[model samples]
Target: MTVATHPLVARARLLADDLLAPHAERVDQAGVPVSHVEAVKRSGLLGVGAPAEYGGAAAPAAVARRTAEILAGACCSTWFVTTQHYTPVKLLAASGLPVRERLLRPLASGELLAGIAYAHVRAFPRVPVRAVPERGGWRFDGTVPWYTGWGLNDVMLLAGVTDAAEVVFAFAEAREQPGLRPSPPMRLAALTASRTVSLRLEGLWLPGKAVVLRTPQKEFAVVDRPRNTNASPAVFGVADAALALLDGVPEAEETARSLRTRLDETRERAYALWDHPVPHERIEERLALKTRSYDLMRAATTAAVVAGGGRSLDLDSRAQRLFREGMFLLVQGQTAEVRRAHLGHLGD
Candidate 1:
């Protein structure tokens, strides 16, 4: 579907313009205001991937990606916070568990927003979090180095590795509880308004019904590699936003257009490889495209900063924000293997 016709695209764009863009600088310094999140919930974009049966849009992947691009380009912090909801929605839809029936409707309807603490699953051998069998449930013990949307999210999808090297994910109350303690929201160089914190899980327990997915570590990695290798649409979104800042400057405008064209071409190819049903095929090619996209993103944001001159150094300026955002995108989905391949591309 065309971006204009897509159910959530127009709404996302409206939110980006009316809410996200206006308060972006304030949010950057003060943290995402609850009112902004309320706006997002009221907009109904949260359910872009939810099943239609539950009053969700359930739009196609391409439409979802475009909507994400719009939101990310408009305001990365808002995008980062709300985007966490989609993963749990997808996980619940795939689980076929009773919890899906209980949670999916409200989550889709925006009655409850969800955040994720499962990225630590990628730290398998390191065992960042460990899950132990307990009475009628599992006890999770460890530290979550990065947990975003702390005060805002109603529920979280938390995962820990078991002794048998299986990863177990369970739904938990997002607020502080006896075993779940969140550090004061961190002061970060970027996306600080997303309200990220380090979570210390001290024997946190969730009953059997709370558990969502449990599988061998090897099996999990098999599924994760392809997903992580794909280029994030946000990278292009941020770059596009930066290029727009250069539009009034004639010299930079021409350069920005060239970079934008190359960015779009590489984005198309990267998404093609990402959507390929065969996960591992053309992996090196995917990494190459991803690296190429990063290069363009850097160039685009740098151009915007250069064009903005003295004003660009202001913390509240759009140019500076986009540049900082570009730095974040570089490591957003990075894995060691992806990092190595990306570095190799730089040498070429």
Candidate 2:
């Protein structure tokens, strides 16, 4: 089936139009509610990229990206919370470890929602969390500077660096356990509804059965760098949403159309590269397209705010929320390489 007609894509559209978009502004201000998350779980979106055998759809990558765009465009806050589930689902699907059998089915079926605490692993040489072999398992100590969907997620795929220069990823309940303490949710310029917090991992221990993937730091970076270089579909989604806000503003019609044209062209080019067989083949081109997407996202959100005038500053204004969310996306999933490339692009 075409990506547009894919059942998952249709469900995402239905979720966006009937529920997410209608309450987006409220969700932004009040935080994503449990009801919204329940709806998502019931919608079967949590398993989009999971293996079909595990009660998942295992849809194509294009379909997955399209669904993300739809949800993010409709309600970025809800999208942020649910988006965390995909990583754990993906990792478990690829793993041969015991945890795979235990968690993959529940995760893939949307019966359990998982969050991720591994972004800190990107720091490499300065590991924020450490996993030392101990007691037939491993001990994790140090801090996870950021953990999103704290109260909402059922489990977390936590990661840490070992002295042997390897990255160890494991699963644990996402709660205040003996050694995993979480700070209160952070207040942010955007997506505060996602319930983000810092995790203090003081001697947190997990059995070997909980471990999923263990790979050399360098090897992990090799796979990770290319993925980060590609533009996120959510960027295009949010940009499009911002551009749509200009529809009612007659004075901004010309500007909106021009930005839309540029957005469409950039999105086309970005997706073309996304579909390239060799992910690592065109590194520079990927980074360039990513930065370009960011540029378009910024311009679109800013134009939305400008077109809204002072009313956009209101807490309930969709334009203002998109503006803040745009700021948040600028740094989401950012790595040192991405930062350097983006800054260099800006300077150029």
Candidate 3:
């Protein structure tokens, strides 16, 4: 089914099939799937959250989860890039009125694609692109990394640090800026087709209603809360992918049981951390919960992928994705050993 013809959730799956799966190899070598990203925009999934006033479906988590899972299965890196910055983009939507009018419609209509500039120097940068505070705007400069979907994005939802070192969301048009280089292409172990890279924004401008986001919710939330924006989708989708790999395997039942159990426990921890009425005694305790959740997700996925008799390792087969996908779990935030230490400290 075409994304346009089906329900939002159905459309999300269709997008994965019609858009990402078919062009997996092409995107792999082409560096960035500019066309594929456009397909996402055209699919109107990007507009799923913006209000109807600003031209969007304002879809729920179920819809987002479905699209994320499917797209991730086909192309892990691209999904990572698209999803990692979701929370920031949503924050911009809360900017209200003029911000929504100027930015939201374009975001929904594919006239604009929003991307996140993360991992810039590993420590957050406080320098502005053009922070002169003249003409009712801020002049800024500096290079940022992990600005996923760089060349294709029309708007940038940046977390810029002020002179006082307070972080704020600077929403602005990306193209007109003279100093921002859209970043060169790079290769990754998995999700290689996501077209993620570093951006060099030198002497840029931020003005009008596009101001820094000051929401305490976004600010205070831990990096891995409800799972990192990237990891949540990757974990769920990779699990789905692994299960798909199990279709013909003799160990399908066993692998599924373990995978489901892990996913359930992870979900419980996520809900507890986010939904509980009380605050965790220590920040690391909460962080450890997230870390363990990630570990379980990885274990289940690896177990499922490798269970299929190593036949998936065939050069042209989908099974090759399993092993490499396992590698992604290793790099997200805290390691297993670190989590153990946190747990040990808590016990002590």
Candidate 4:
């Protein structure tokens, strides 16, 4: 379907394609893509998850999915970074009425750049962080490493354990807070345009206003819904990128057809749970399908690598970037191990 049929997604595709195609080499060489960030902000896309009340489109999961897919076709890293913005804000919007006013408005308007810092590299940070009581609020003294897009984000939905709660979002700014120690941006395989950094919170403080969830041991918002839809567009985008590569290969039309069917199968199954969280059986089945898709991404990248040869290894080759970025699928968490876990948990 044409993006114009859904203006927001259409716009997302156009910008992603433009920046990703022309600037892929530049982004890889320079590391990080500040220029595209500016373009994204200007396109009103930064506000994708803000409530309509705050002048945002406040689009649904479907639109978000389409936008991601379009962007992924050109640059998976950019697409990954792009998805981080809205879903987290959507989480903020769900934090009862108080949070919506305090953080949602500026965030939706692109007046703020924000990110989620929950992955601790040991797995997900499924805790409220260390929230010792303080005046009017609690102090957050901990670190969430591998926080992607730190440099551009003005706010962060920091998750931590506060003596209660399984997961919650903390609204934090890039302030000179005593407890919050931020590192210079780190290097990575892709999406380097974002300011990924290690955040050490010694005495980094937060006001009650910044703490979005205070309920102990309870999930403040629903991540299951959006996270599912959020992945499809990008996965599809990778497929699109793969197809593009295949078109240049010998018997490329046959390769394209074979790949497209697998891609379509993936899209259908991924979207099957759009209206619901993936059931245990479906999740396991998808673990296999998703693993297959990851393999496809590598295979496609290999084609680019083969076609490109040594030039692909050059400092200015799109093939190398594709190869590096395509490798993300390998770790995308859709392997047999995860499938077995899901399968084992089927009856539990």
Candidate 5:
């Protein structure tokens, strides 16, 4: 379906034009208001990747990616806060556990927003969080270095590494619980409006049913690698928004056109590798595209800032915001392998 006609895509554009874009500066400065999240919930974009059997739209991957691009371009903060919901939805949909019956429908229907606390899984050999078997359940201890949408999410998919070298992913209420506490939201260089914080899990316990996915660490790595190598759609979204800001400036028009062409080419290659059915195929190509996209994003945002001149430094200016957002996207889904590969590409 075309983006202009797809219900979800149309809703995203509506949100961008009517709500997100108009107040994005204020929202970025003051923080993502509950109203923004409520609007997202009402739009039903949270179910983009969820199974249709559970009341989800389950739109095509291209549509979902484009919707994300629209939302990110309009307001990265709102996108940051709401984007966390999809991971948990995907996990629960594929989990085949009893908790899926209890949580999937509400999550899929946008009745219960979810967030993620699973990035630490990428910190291999470090084991930032540990899970131990306890009274027919599991106990998580250690810290989640970064937990976004702290107060905004109703539930979270918390993950920890087990002593046996397996990874355990489980769901829990996002709020403070018996052994879980959240630091006040962090003051970040960008996307502070997302209400991000660090979580301390001290013997956080969950029944067996709460556990969703349990697999060997090696197996988890095998699954995670391909995902990380691909470019994030947000990179292109922010870049596109910046380019739009330079549309009429003769000095920037040529640069914007050049970067847009490169961005489109890189995105095509990245998505091809990402959508390839053959696992582990073209991984280097994916990483190369990801790094190239980052370069284009930086160029696009810098050009916008230059076109805006001193005015771009204003906190209310979209140029400055998009610049910072680009910086955030650079490291958003970072992994050591991704980092090394990105650095190699930069050196090239």
Candidate 6:
């Protein structure tokens, strides 16, 4: 079957059309409800990239990316919450560690949703969170400044840096516990429905069996840098959704067609680099395409707002939502390198 016809992709489309899109505005204003998350879990889209033996579809990367686009376009807030599940699944699938046997199946099968607390690891020398060796396990102390899907997720893959400069990733129940305290969710300009909060890890301890992956900071950066260089599929998804707003406006027909062509071209180049066999090669090219995608996303979302006229300023406006979401995407997974490159591109 074609990627479009893939079961997981088709399920994503159905979920997007029937549920996510219809309630996106409501969810945006009211915060994403537990029911919306339950619908996603039942749809089985959670296991798109997981191993088949673990009750997952084990679909190709193309299928996974396509599903992400559909969901993000339909409701970026919902997409953001669910998107955190994939990383833990991926790490566990590749790991021979004891944690793999324990959490992989449940996560891959959508029986358990996982959130991530590892992005702060990107700070490197600044190390906001620290992991110190303890009694046959580890002790994590410090703060996770940004943790999304807090109350909604069943577990979290938390990370902290050791004095040896090793990045330690481990699993813990995502809850208020003995040593883990979560701050109230922050109100943001976009995707506030995602339930984002800060985590304080004061002597939070996990057994060695809970550990997933531990790698040297430099080695981790080697893999992580390339991944961040690629354009996020969500960018195209939100852009396409915004362009559709223009397509429906009679006076914006020419503008819609012109922008669609540019978007398609940029998307093709970005994905080609994303799928390249050698991820580490063409680093600059990847960053260039990524920034280009961001530019197009901004333009498309802006056009949508302009076409929307004064109504676009309303809280329920899809155009306004997409525009704010686009703004959020600009800094979503930003790294020093990405920021420098994007700013440099803007300067040029």
Clashes of each: 0, 0, 16, 20, 0, 0
Task: Report, for every candidate in turn, its global Cα lDDT versus the true structure.
Answer: 0.88, 0.93, 0.59, 0.64, 0.91, 0.93
Clash pairs, candidate 5, are none
Q: Give per-residue lDDT, candidate 6, residue 20.
A: 97
- Candidates 1 and 2 compared by TM-score, better number: 2
What digit string (tens of lDDT, one per residue) describes model 3 on residues 1-348? 543344776767887887776665455556546677777777777776666666777776555666776777776656665664455557656666367656666776556777765333124333423233557766566666565666666667765555555455567665545756766665777655566666676766667477745433235344323343223555566666666666666656776767677776665565455444544334465555555555665565666546755665654455566557656644644434354654574476
lDDT of 6 at 317: 97
Measured against the true structure, the TM-scores of the candidates, in listed sequence, are: 0.97, 0.98, 0.76, 0.84, 0.97, 0.99
Write the residue-wise lDDT of candidate 1 on 1-348 in tens digits: 686787688898889988898878888888888898889998899998888999688887887888888888888998999999998998898987778888889899898999999888887799999999899899999999999899999999999999899999889989999899999988877888889999999989899899888989999898888877888889989988998998879878679879989998998898888778898788888888888889999999999999999999999899899898888888876789888988888898
Model 2 stretches astray by more than 4 angstroms? none
Q: What is the lDDT for 194 in model 1? A: 89
Which ranges in model 5 have alpha carbons more than 4 Å from their true place? none
Model 1 per-residue lDDT at 257: 78
- The order by descending lDDT is 6, 2, 5, 1, 4, 3
Q: Where in model 3 is the C-alpha error above 4 Å? A: 1-6, 118-135, 175-177, 212-231, 268-289, 308-315, 329-348
| Model 6 TM | 0.99
By TM-score, the best candidate is 6
The pairs that clash in candidate 1 are none
63-129 per-residue lDDT for model 2 (tens digits): 9999999999999999999999998998999998889999999999999999999999888799999
Worst 10 residues of 6 by lDDT: 246-255
Where in model 4 is the C-alpha error above 4 Å?
A: 1-4, 121-129, 215-232, 277-281, 332-348
Clashes of 2: 0
- Model 6: lDDT equals 0.93
